[model samples]
Target chain A: MWDYTDKVKELYTNPKNVGKIDDADVVAEVGSIVCGDALKLYLKIDDNDIITDAKFETFGCGSAIASSSALTEMIVGKNVKEVEKITNQDIVKYLGGLPEEKMHCSVMGHEALEKALKQLKGEKVEDHVDEEGEIICHCFGVTDDLIRRVIRENNLKTVEDITNYTKAGGACGSCIPKLEDILEEEAAKPASDKKKEETKKPLTNIRRMQLVEETITNVIRPILQEDRGDIELVDIDGKNVYVALRGSCSNCMVSNVTLKNLVEAKLREYVENDIVVHEIK
Target chain B: MERVVYLDNNATTMVAPEVVDAMLPYLSGKYGNPSSIHSFGGDVGADIAQAREKIARFVGADHDYEIVITGSGTESDNLAILGSIAYYKDKRHIITSRVEHPAVISLCKKLERDGYRITYVPVDAKGNLDLAYLKESVDDDTAIVSIMYANNETGVIFPVEEIGEFLKEKGIPFHVDAVQAAGKIPIDVNKINCRLLTISGHKFHAPKGIGALYVRRGTRLRPVLYGGHQEKGRRPGTENVAGIIGMAKAAELAMEHLANIDEMKRLRDKLEEGLLSAFKNASLNGDKEKRVPNTSNIGFEFIEGEAILLYLDAKGIAASSGSACSSGSLEPSHVLRAMGVPFTSAHGSIRFSLSRYTTEEEIDYTLKTMPEIVNRLLTISPYWDNEKQEGKPINL
Candidate 1:
């Protein structure tokens, strides 16, 4: 059984705002029965751009029902602009939390809400097809655009994470290498670039040391250790972070390239753009 | 908590009271290494031998020595498939059904990865095995043929006896995974002409952690585990003495209860009939006549199974589903998919397996409560239409 939160259980047991709005302004359906979940959303909007009412009809699991119920509760009596800003994370937070495997339930709610709003704005609403790219995960009919968007929104790294968030590589698993390529491509971009741009500053010596150590431990070590190697944060001086490669990494032929490319690139992405990683050899 | 009407017996049955009582002595005073030379342990070996004899008799095996007890049904399957493949030595091909339980299917998949050719014979729309395909797939390099006696999801019985006869004529090794069928239905290793068969204890009211593999005499089989001389070194680990005793007692009780099979079938048919008649779109998932008497897999169109299960659970009812959401997987049951079950109903499939302990009161309660659950879900189901009393067609 899934480790569902009490709130999720409660909502699933007695979901609110169920059924379709007969005379609603716009209706949108997302997901599919074959995909194991779908939601049809109904909305009644007032002339003042306020949501007079919101309701949903969901066909999925307990979390899916809870998410649809939570979505309707969160959207009713709110302005269209506010409802538009409600991400799947907001619905998850509303219900305390859902099991990671059921995160796609919340994503289904968010997608239905997005589709409803888009339909209300007179935009083309295709149920399964995405405007961004072709389908990638054929088993679940998840498109590349949907996969990439979920990856970016959820900050998903591994194929398992993508499966939990979007159900892209969860079945058959033939698209896992493609999922890995997508992860690598997405990881190349700086995480939260806007925040990085806003927080550009000269750091104190202690803070620089802390950031370098954190980066090495969190990011660099796992990669090196995957290859039966290790790295230790020996010292940090201004923009130059000194690291000691251990085990197989120490005797590696391309240790210099690894230090300059992988370790330095991570330190720069996490600590500072000018941060450099130096081997202690 | 309210009384739980557990219909998920196919997943695991409640340990029989008699079985538990039979095992308590082994857990307490009889806890001795069966391998020891002294009477303290030597007597325990005698009890284990008696248990094996009972189990062998229950499954209609010719000799007690043919039964190699293992950790679980999965281990028996692994030992059977891998052991037979090892015996073949040069043969690198295997034949299995598409609707097999993971114990056999996953092993076949791994063998495929190791450069072994695997033929996953398809099933018909009624969940019947494609026997002609199986016959055509067999060739000189076919190491073994592994197929389940009864599908776990649909309770559909394959033509194992026929397949067994054909393979017997061709001088090929055949393994039947009888985990779901052993106690529910009668199993005769000689009748099926199979070289190996697997049975789990837990499915027949025995405690978990014990299973057995029937290796026919003179079958060239290799041992999967290497260690102490237990089960003639076929499975070398220390015996699960308590579990073996429980299973023996359970099997004896099952033999006694075999006459009551028709009673279990009556309750199953009543539940299946009540549910199908109550819902317009509901239908059975497999061949109704050619299935194990204890199981009924019903599908309610236009709704997902997990949602229906949660509703059933709210009313203190327990059952199993073929929906992907139920298993934390993104695809519906492979058995259902292989049977060509439409997407409209595949996600909504639910299986109710009955045991001898099931009562008419529990079945009636489920029959009464299920309509309310299905109607409630229908109101919140996007494809369900209240006025039309039918599901809306969508491009799934």
Candidate 2:
């Protein structure tokens, strides 16, 4: 049912370098049978740091095997350093394309090659270690570092993108909130740095007013609109800005929490950190 | 050219030539509204009556009126479960096996969300329903108990007769989803004593849009749909005349070939035995002797099933898998997982289902092509190293 490319189908049927090199320079395996896909790569790297031969044994679906096969073909006769540059996207490109859900197969191939190079360097490599962060998704054993790296490397925009690339939050989905936190953090990385620069300057009274109005229109009002509520900037007096909650927010039980946590937080972040808000009842 | 061996009949069947022949006149020349007062409509109504008679006889129901033609097996299931719950407003509980088809399970889930208590009777590793749990779960508030006659994935027939007998003593309504069992095996309302049973036309040799629900006489059911007096106001709409005729024809043919079920069994056994023997790490997933004659679910260790299925597909052999990739999820088949099939093998499980039209040659082709495919995948599988490792049990 996966719309695998003709090249993927061809490579899966008659995968090249399927057997293992018994006396190889380095052997690296990634994934597990429990996770539904695993791959063991046997590499024969020569003295010049060039991969003389590469073979793989993969336990997974057709796309996984095809991705492994493509990885082997792409790495053979190439420098070990250059092989490190070949990302999962490169393997996907070699196979023409894989279904969005099966992109993790190509990621597995890229990971095996990375592990093989690390093993060839005589480093003590442990299987399944993220090398960047702790495990976040227990079902798939996807670490926070892996999720973050994929989000940054692939310019991932949604939780589904992370699942497609790294298989986080694709099972059980209990870690979905954690993945969302990571995505938000990664997405705000550039903006946060820019915010620090903008925060250092002294706030002109007019600039403070415009910034407060912009934050309300662009951020605070939209959040309140989700609950069928609205807010109006009644008046602004220096650090104290007076506002009135309208619609559903007028008599809401948690309107105070919304004002402090949502409204004041936006004002502190966008305007001066000392800005105070007053509700005009 | 490839041989094109179709072993996915459990998913859907090829429309038989005879069934098409029987339905052709209704599609064109005999296109009369069965509800009309004209003679043209009267003749069509008479044909529907005859079809109903044959279908009633096929399922061993007492009267033709017991068979209510619906759009699909899911509709019949909805009609039975929702209708029973609606009829018994004071009762707010339902009991169903964990492995019932999504039609029953999902509807139960919706009912649960609607403030109804649902007791999902678990099954053992062999896919047998926990009857003691079912008995314990039933209370005064139990509205109905819906269990499938045969599992669609594994084809493991449940002890519906025993369940029926138990529920009969308790005076609780029982519904049986017989979609997979209708044409493959014999079904008798008298033997099972079920209050309602569902059948899909396409599961046999009929077209896809027709199904039947057998409601035992005196079992009051609120109509799920309302329009006209079609299907005696049970399913109200214009009747799918040709589909109903085709289903009746399929039922007639099914009755005629009831004795030939052994032939299908023989082919299935041959394929199962050959594949299980060909691969040292392979094993059967469901109850070997208690399954339907047409189905064989096998688990091949180490390798994933979608890979094997794709390899088999390339060889012109069609099979299905319980693997996560095949199912469009990261979790493998829930049925297999519920059976406690380890993740290692559950991801590698494949199902081959046969039909009455299967040939021994097709079986031979599958037997010949399967080993090479498994062997090829095994060579690439890191776990396949001439030794068996008891796979770790997965929580999914």
Candidate 3:
């Protein structure tokens, strides 16, 4: 059985605002029955852009209902900005916590709130428009972009983690290969600009030589030699990788930028955190 | 607090008082090893033999030696499937249904990865196995056909007797998982004429962790576990004496209560009929006529099952669901999915199973209280279309 908090049990047993509003200022529907949870959030806002009342109609499990009810209670009497700042985590906090499997219910609550907030702003609800990415999971209608965004934001590394966060590939599991591909692409990220600044490892003489040779073969030389620009490993001392530009690179005018931008940046991905490539005349 | 109405017997059963009484001696005082040579220990082997004979007779097997006791139904299943496949090395095919329990289904999946061709015979929308497909799929190299006597989720009994006869004619070994069917209905290995049948003790009023496998006297099976001479080298370990004794007593009580199965069936029908009458947009999952006497898998549209289950739990009622919300996954039970149940209702499916101990008062209280819960939930359901007077089925 799920270890539900007493607050969740209380709110679930007697949800604050249920049923759709008659003449609401904004109505936002998120999710569908196919995904096993759907929440339609109804909002009644004042002239000053303050939410006077919030009601919800949901077709889902206990956590989903609890989350929608909790979302309604949290957003009522709060201004638009404050309501917008309330995230899925905020809703979960209101209910103490939800089971890890039921976290998607809170996410559904957040989606409904965001949609209602957008409608209140007189903006398009962004439903029925697959502008971000094509739907990969046909069962739940989850898009690749949604899956990618969840993976990036949560730093999720596996398809299972993606399902746990976004409900993507959780149903039918036919899109698992696509999810795997996206996970592989995300995990295969190259070293960033920030990483190229610092070289933390103190290198021994033999280790420095290994780093110099490895960088030349694996990183620095591959791209340069492809463009008829050859680089030879000269020596390494401390964080500096000394190299000689050969072939077309010898006469290249932009070799200075190339050495700093491509060579140094690429080498930092593999060899060390900080390694400056200096051309030896 | 109201009395706890247990309708989850398919999950596990309460141990009968008599079974406990029969097992106490073996559990405490009679702790001698059954394999020992001394008189004190050798006497325990006679008790083990007596229990085995009782279980063997309960399943209507001719000889008691054909029964091999094991830890649980899953162990018995593994022993039957893997053991037969090992004994028949030249054969490289397995046939089972799509709705078998995970114990059978997952093993078939592993066998597929090991380069053995496996045919998962599909079922109809009512969860009936496609026997023609099973016949067509069987070939000369088909190693074994493993089909359950009754599905755990739906309680739809398959025609295992008919299935066994045809498979035997094709010169193939057949194994029946009678774990769910043993105490609920009559099972005769001779009538089914299958080479192997597996049964769990806990499905009836027995303690958990004991099961039995019926292997025809001449059937060859390579043992999955190897240690000592217990279970005639088929299952080589010190036997669970207390558990086996409890199972034997459960089997005997099951025979005594066989005449009262009709009464349990009547109570089950009352619950099914009452729930159906009280709720709108609800439907039964499996075939109504072809199911066991005590299980009703129902789907209540527009509300998630876990939500209903939690409410029921609050009211001192016990039931279970294979719905997506009940399971951690977004898809419901594979049994429901394979039956082509639409996603709108499949997410709210519930399985209510009754046993011999159920009373009419409990059923009456459930029938009275459940409608209120359903009505309460429907008021807040977004899919409850008031104008149309029914919960609207969401277009997937």
Contacts from the true interface found in each model, as a fraction, amount to 0.95, 0.84, 0.88
Error of 2 at B28 (Å): 1.4
Q: lDDT (CA) for every model shown?
A: 0.89, 0.88, 0.85
The reply for model 3, stretches above 4 Å from the true place, is: A126-131, A184-281, B386-388
**Which candidate wins on TM-score?**
1
- In candidate 3, position A139 carries an lDDT of 75
Per-residue lDDT of model 1, residues A139-215, tens digit only:
87788888888876665768998999888889889999999998998877665674666676777899988888888
Clashing pairs in 1: none
User: Which of 1 and 3 is the better model by DockQ?
Assistant: 1
Give per-residue CA lDDT, model 2, range B172-218, as digits (tens).
99999999998899999889989999999999999998999999999
Clashing residue pairs, backbone N/CA/C < 3 A, model 2: none
**Distance from true location, Cα of B37 in model 1, Å:** 1.6
Task: Candidate 3: give the clashing pairs.
Answer: A199-A274
Model 1 DockQ class: medium
Which parts of model 2 have CA positions greater than 4 angstroms off? Answer: A122-124, A193-281, B386-396
TM of each candidate vs. truth: 0.89, 0.84, 0.86
lDDT tens digits by residue: candidate 2, A33-104: 888988889999889989999999888998998999999999889997788888886787678667878889
Question: What C-alpha lDDT, on a 0 to 100 scale, does residue A43 get in candidate 1?
Answer: 97
